[model samples]
Target: MSAMTGELAMCGASVETLFEESVEPVVELVLGGQSARVALFGATVISWRTGARDRLWMSSLSARDGSAPIRGGVPIAFPQFADQGPLTLHGFARTARWRLADRKANLDGTLVEARFVLARSAIADTQGWVGDFELRYTVRLGVRRLELELQVANLGSAPFDFTACLHTYLLLDDVRNVTLHGLSGLEYFDKVAGRDRDEVNDAIRVEAASHSSGDVLGQRAEGFVDRIYRAGGERSPLTLQHAASGETYSIAQSGFPDTIVFNPWVAGKKGTKGPDFDDDGYNHMICVEPAITREGSGPIRVSPGSTWAGTQTIQVL
Candidate 1:
């Protein structure tokens, strides 16, 4: 799968904006057999496919009109994560329209980069997070790999604090057959149980791996999970092994010390309720997010004129 030829090619890939399902502008980045589609509405990556096989899970019930946050793919949670802070839900970055400041298809399509900028203005003022901040989100598409970097630069006179995460919703063949490795003995804050505990084993089942309730900070662990694991000093990639499909995906991150492993299996309970993602849809989606929160790893305190950045990379194995 070579780069698109003729006038359609720039550098080596095709970088273009087209109005697809909504009137909002969406950027399409195609590199060889790999492609990613990002919408300016939230600078969200709605779709990512390699070899024509869908690698991302996007909710069919999600709002496509930019009225609300698209419930799937990768939604950038910034200034706030979840309802933990004063800001609304996942913050304005996921709902505000961003400007595509730069696009480059470099090195004969081996690497493609697109940078999105979110400035402090109505987005921050309306969301009650008023500050002179500049967020530069860069998405790089390469051979069998996708890297996402979020750079936050504080341009305000006073220092501002923010908690952010790449709320990535990954598509899987089956949630039951999924097992995560690398978080063997790390402590995690179980949001469901409202307590903190340690992972006693290497294999993390969708439910309780042990019969003891306190072992996992709960009694008879339910069918879903919404916990944040502290990846303390562990820089190795977290591998998600899909038993059924016999495929594996490696997730690595830097500058983010927390990892959120969530699978709202049959979404119905409280915070897990995703109207866009039905009960059955939960069977095919898992969120392995690299994040920083006020509760777990603490919020990012960016000093005035200082810049903070984090990158999450995904590789298919």
Candidate 2:
């Protein structure tokens, strides 16, 4: 059997092997003038660049030894999110190694796709969970757009539930100059205040009260901001403006009901901690996660022989 599978390109899209010395093999994908770097360790996309700028960010101090989850890029949170379940912090998917199941570049070379698979049979401890399950993660990189999809299928006779999220850290020229639009009047649970509130911000609004969206969801001049906003059936496009760069990015989601906006501005202040990030790094990246993290009401349940899937797309504008 072949140890891995790979394909060539026609126009410009191609998948190349990379980072052979790391704990897990890395794959470098190029589509037209845009390119991305993904590691098989967690099937994580660690870097994305178009032209002269990077769209994704990875912390300098991130643990690359595979002992802990890397502190940046797009980390796949599966089975459970946070400490809400019996599993570890963000589940095992982020740290567990994944297998490259398929790779292909379209004949036209306008797009490239890579598929990775993870199964219980591939894990050693199973993390105290039992069942026959397979998680399929697919990344489709096009010339101007990036699409990410996660599919979970149950192979056993019993039903199972899982909460998942694509924790995406977007690199920015300056966090203070960035703005997230189209999140008005939505509800959110403030992790710091431990309460639920409404988002009334219009243009990156930051209020005296933490966790509540005023008229906008903008970065503050100082301090940290972390909140989980609930987007209930609201599929309006979310846009992020990188003011300094004079560029804007649009985000859209399907099968994902909630969105998480977080930025730990300064380390070692107000109970904030970032062991893997540089103190000044907070001003360069922001996390916007598409997640379903409800305690018992939000998990995606897959019946025996059934499957559940979700997709999120990011585009540069």
Best by TM-score: 1
* Model 2, span 191-248: residue lDDT tens: 6555687777865522233334333333332444666777632644688887777887
Screening candidate 1 with a backbone cut-off below 3 angstroms (N, C-alpha, C), the clashing residue pairs are: none
Deviation of model 2 at 252, angstroms:
0.8
Q: What is the C-alpha lDDT of each candidate?
A: 0.80, 0.76
Residue 67 CA displacement from its true place in model 1, Å: 0.8
> Which digits, one per residue and each the tens of the lDDT, describe model 1 over residues 239-288?
98999878888889998878888876533323246566755777788888
Candidate number achieving the greatest lDDT relative to the actual structure: 1
Candidate 2 wrong stretches, greater than 4 Å? 1-7, 205-222, 268-272, 295-297
Question: What is the clash count for each candidate, in the order shown?
Answer: 0, 12
**Model 1 TM-score (2 dp):** 0.90
Model 1 stretches with alpha carbons more than 4 Å out: 1-11, 21-23, 122-124, 207-221, 268-272
